[model samples]
Target: MLPIQPSPRRKAIAAWFQDRLAWDSVREFIAHKTVPVHSGTIWYAFGGITLFLFVIQVVTGILLLVYYRPTPSEAYESVQFIVTRVAFGWLIRSIHIWSANLLILSAFVHMISVAFLHAYRKPRELVWLSGIVLLALALGFGFSGYLLPWNTISFFATKVGTDMATFIPWMGSTVGRYLRGGDAVGGATLTRFFGFHVAVLPALTSLFLLFHLGLVQKFGISTPPWVEKRSRGAGTRPPQMPFFPDFFLHELMVWYGALALLGILAAVFPWELGQKADAFASAPAGIRPEWYFLAPFYTLKLIPGHVAGMEGEVVGLLGFGLLAFWWAALPFWGARPDGTVRSKLVTGGAVAFLAYLSTFSLLGYLR
Candidate 1:
């Protein structure tokens, strides 16, 4: 004997919304939208902005690919064609570049905010770990894209970058060789990078993002800084707003705003293609990396040279390996009984170091 369900009128209305219109969930959630006290600040906006920029990158990257030729000979010319002939091509490329910068910026801000507020503790640790992985991949995305223009800067930069890897104690040369796909940075290197920049990395990023977002939802928003003592009723509840309508409306606004900002940047200062990469050309002046890379560049700069028989390069390489190892093992390491305050302090210290290095780099640039 089954219990009687709702009246047919009520069932029809529910079906109409759940099946046809997608607004039913939004309505239900809004009826329960008791705003969290801690989430009403500007810091919360950055995560939304980060997601919006990623969407822009995907769309603009796909558009650029439509005109891009990944071969050695045709690559430069195809990019030139995009610059000159394609409709709003400069705008699209500019948006791609600017959005990438914005994405990195927002992600860093979001991470720092989460760290300061102890949002990465306990159940939320996986989300934080996933974010760190995403950050590394984002850097790789920039590294791979940097070489695509095949210009003097990109060429020398790639050489310097790969050479840095080769400075590792045991596996450096092997890794460098694998990256180059040959004796030096040649056509094969370009082709490999093209696949990495446009394909492999993007696919991985998409997959991780699905898990990252799902984990975030599962854990719910990290309570804002002010919520010192969370009781059962203090945190966000399960019947939250549907991501499709209520949340997505905000997402849509952010996306449009980011696009407009990118448009203005493109119109003001379109990206320039530097001299075509010559294996023999002299290095260009001010050989700084893209903005996002300044932190690592600074890290490599900051580490003191020569520890115990090892050269500065070796020490730096070892330090990088340790950092990456820690990042990979963080889920397990976090499982240990370290206090939340200690974790926050460690994260803060690393961020501060990066900030110090970045400031120095900018001053060096200005000088």
Candidate 2:
């Protein structure tokens, strides 16, 4: 049988794009790349899921921005208008809020999966560091965006959060001033946080995300130690599936599932637009920051006001700083000089950390 050939117009168009874009190289790369297939492979989807949620966040955020006024005088009213007046605006805002929460949750899962799978060992150190930075930026997005509505709860929560910043020793006051754009949370703080949520954080996250993805591409997927050891013991190679169709299609399905969950949450329980912030009013009792920040927030609450002549808040902040340093530098201490991971120690630490976060977050939410 004779083969079908492209028409002259189609051929010309293809040639034009191939000349300008050189997309063939990308196709070639995709065709050749493969993902290691194993029990832990499913965990890799969380990274893609996080990215998907981020894209959702950007789209919904842009839609909300059309009607959002950054000034405290108008912020609450503007949000009210979006939820009540604009068509499906409530759903859009809800999805944005829910997706932001899910994005952080997915990032945490991805990080924990990496730790458990020992994917951060050796040459992938930069990847792990970049991921940590990206996660931090995700948290920054949450903290900054939480106050955009300028509601009473958010107002007081941000006030407490910025106050905690003042416990950072040398740079605490500076950071607090920078974040508030003054000594207190007010119109300036709302405007400043708006800039951060929309502009500063997105820019930083984009850079770190690109770096992390590039490193992942360069190193390919890491096979867990157990997987590799099993293959070696059995005298067989670890199996893999082509990235183009097999793994990519699986990832697409997972993204669809996430979208479905997001829609259900947004539709069933729309995000609240609380009362407008009254700067003169007393702070509400039991007001707290978002769930992600609840762990440390609750911990700080339990500490005595003064600890051994130092402010308890300061002591808590210092302890958190040390723990953060240890977590971020996991690649350094996690693996031994002989290129073997301290799997038991790392696993134990991760379990303990997760327990602390979950328990404190629940307590903070309840009390």
Candidate 3:
């Protein structure tokens, strides 16, 4: 058979795009990029999975926004209309809620994997910082979107969450007012949160996500310390695979699996709209924030009204702040001066932190 060649018209179209978009450089970068191959390589897919879920969130959120009204009077009704009236609206809403939850879960897993692999050491510090910021933004997205349905549970939960913000010492009241848009979770609070969920948070997330991805590309994937040591002892470099087809295709498969899981969950257990929020009604019993916040929520509940002459909530908030700072600064403390990881110490800290979160969150749910 004769060799096939591009038709003149197809060649012209390709040349036109090449001339205008200059995408050749991007292709060149992809062609040259490689990822380390090891047992830990599978952990890299979680980052891509988190990114996939974020894209899912943006798509579903826009679909819901077309019919959603942001005001207190209309918010619940708007959601009800979406699920009840629009075609497949119920599925879309359910997917959005489920994907939001999974996005947070995936982000946490990615962060933990990075920690365990010591991927945050040395030049990748900024990458780690950017990732931590992105995770915080993901949580922000969840918190802001939680109240958009304007249900009884969400309203009380937001009130409780905002009230908790008021224990941050000097800026507590100001931050609380800012979050609530005044004194309480009312009409203005709803509007503010809606704006944040749709606009502000997304914008910030995009910027940070771009920075994070850029750093990842610049640094390339990091092999675990033990893997590098083993490679050195063997007098051979670690094995690697092309990032384009090999890793990218595997990541796509993982995304498809995630999509399948999401569809099954959404179909089997569609998210409930619950009762319309009544600000005057006594809060329904057992009001609590979503699972992501449950650990801190339950911890706060256990604290007495006072601790060592300071408000217990204030003390708890300060403790949380310190813990967050410590975790975020892991890239510094996790490594020794000689560019080696303090493996035992870092692993112990991670285990303890995981234990605390899991134990408290489970107890919070059960109680």
Candidate 4:
């Protein structure tokens, strides 16, 4: 016997949804969209890569949350049981951890590529700013989730990180207390971080992501300066491929590759739980924040005790503040007829900053 099909009533409801949703308009938009083919085509996929990792984080995080406990006393114990007892729990947790790191990494590369391609000119400024916000949220996710396991390393690292916030110019102490929920990292801090990690950050991220994509759809993808200049000289538009099948199919291939890598990493080096946090006990030596935080962490550690009568941490914090301000204001800086940064100095400075980041991060890890 053949399987029963949907009743007339169900078919009518489905047709109503299709009409209400305006599937025809969506199809029209996709039909008109095209992806540019050039040397820069590969860089276009970095956005898709970041998005893929984000979806992975969402799925795995929900699974982990089903078994996780937020209180200090039970947080570590719950995670321990999930990994050791629950079916495929270790793999889910490991994938979450590894993909979170990769998400940030992919976002960084995507932003840097945008900068090099000068994609932030004029109309794309909001896109760049939105992306910067997303990067900050990704870091926030890392910081908040670090404290979730309530492990020894995470405990001390949060203390150090929150302590650094105290160097903020005006609301230093207030901010530190706000982040930790008290004088130090404790039960309150665990609960606060867990709330931000699972609830607050995700909500903000979703809104910003929607706005960013809406702007991208409105403005369309940017062509690099060189590519645009060449096309103009040739008196012809650049080659284009259909967005639906061509570009999206390429994205699927990259996603498959990333998924394979995540599986291998999850299997080969499963995430491990360190000793449970002890607020009163001594923290182990060499405790450090996550890798992204290392450069600033070691910068503070290496600063002189006093710089022109100012506290080292204060000085370091001010210097980093200036650096961050410059990065944030990039969209408005060096505006021209074409609104692109043509200064060699700007490029040199970016290269120098990357070098500084790499050197200090390596030193921090080694120390």
> What would the TM-scores of all predictions be?
0.81, 0.97, 0.97, 0.94
- Candidate 2 structure quality by residue, lDDT tens digits, 1-367: 9899999999999999999999999999889998988988999999999999999999999999999999988999999999999999999999999999999999999999999999999999999999999999999899999999999999998998898898888999999999899999999999999999999999999999899999998999899999999999999999889998999999999999999999999999899987899999998787888899999989998999899999999999998899889999999999997778999999998999899999999999999
- Candidate 2 residue pairs in clash (backbone atoms < 3 Å): none
Over the stretch 1-367, how does candidate 3's per-residue lDDT look in tens digits? 9999999999999899999999899899999899998988999999999999999999999999999999999999999999999999999999999999999999999999999999999989999999999999999899889999999998988898898898887898999999999998999999999999999999999999999999998889999999899999999998889999989999999999999999999999999999999999998888777899999989988999999999898889898899989999999999987789999988999999899999999999989
Off by over 4 Å in 3: 1-4
lDDT of 3: 0.93
lDDT winner, 1 or 2 = 2
Pull out the clashing pairs in model 1: none
Count of backbone collisions within predicted model 3: 0
For candidate 4, the per-residue lDDT at 222 reads: 85
Candidate 1 yields a Cα-based lDDT of 0.75
State the lDDT at 346 in candidate 3.
89
Q: Where does candidate 3 clash, by residue pair?
A: none
**Model 4: per-residue lDDT, tens digit, 1-367?**
9999999999898789888896878889988888777898899899989999999999999999999999998999999998999999999999999999889889988987887777887888899999999999999999999999999999998998899899998999999999999998899999999999999999999999999989988888888777877899999897788989889999999999999999999999998898999988897887887889889989988899999999999999899989877876666773466665664545665677789889999999999
> What local lDDT does model 4 show for residue 256?
99
Q: Which 10 successive residues of model 3 have the least lDDT summed?
A: 283-292
Residue 249, model 3: Cα distance from true site in angstroms: 0.8
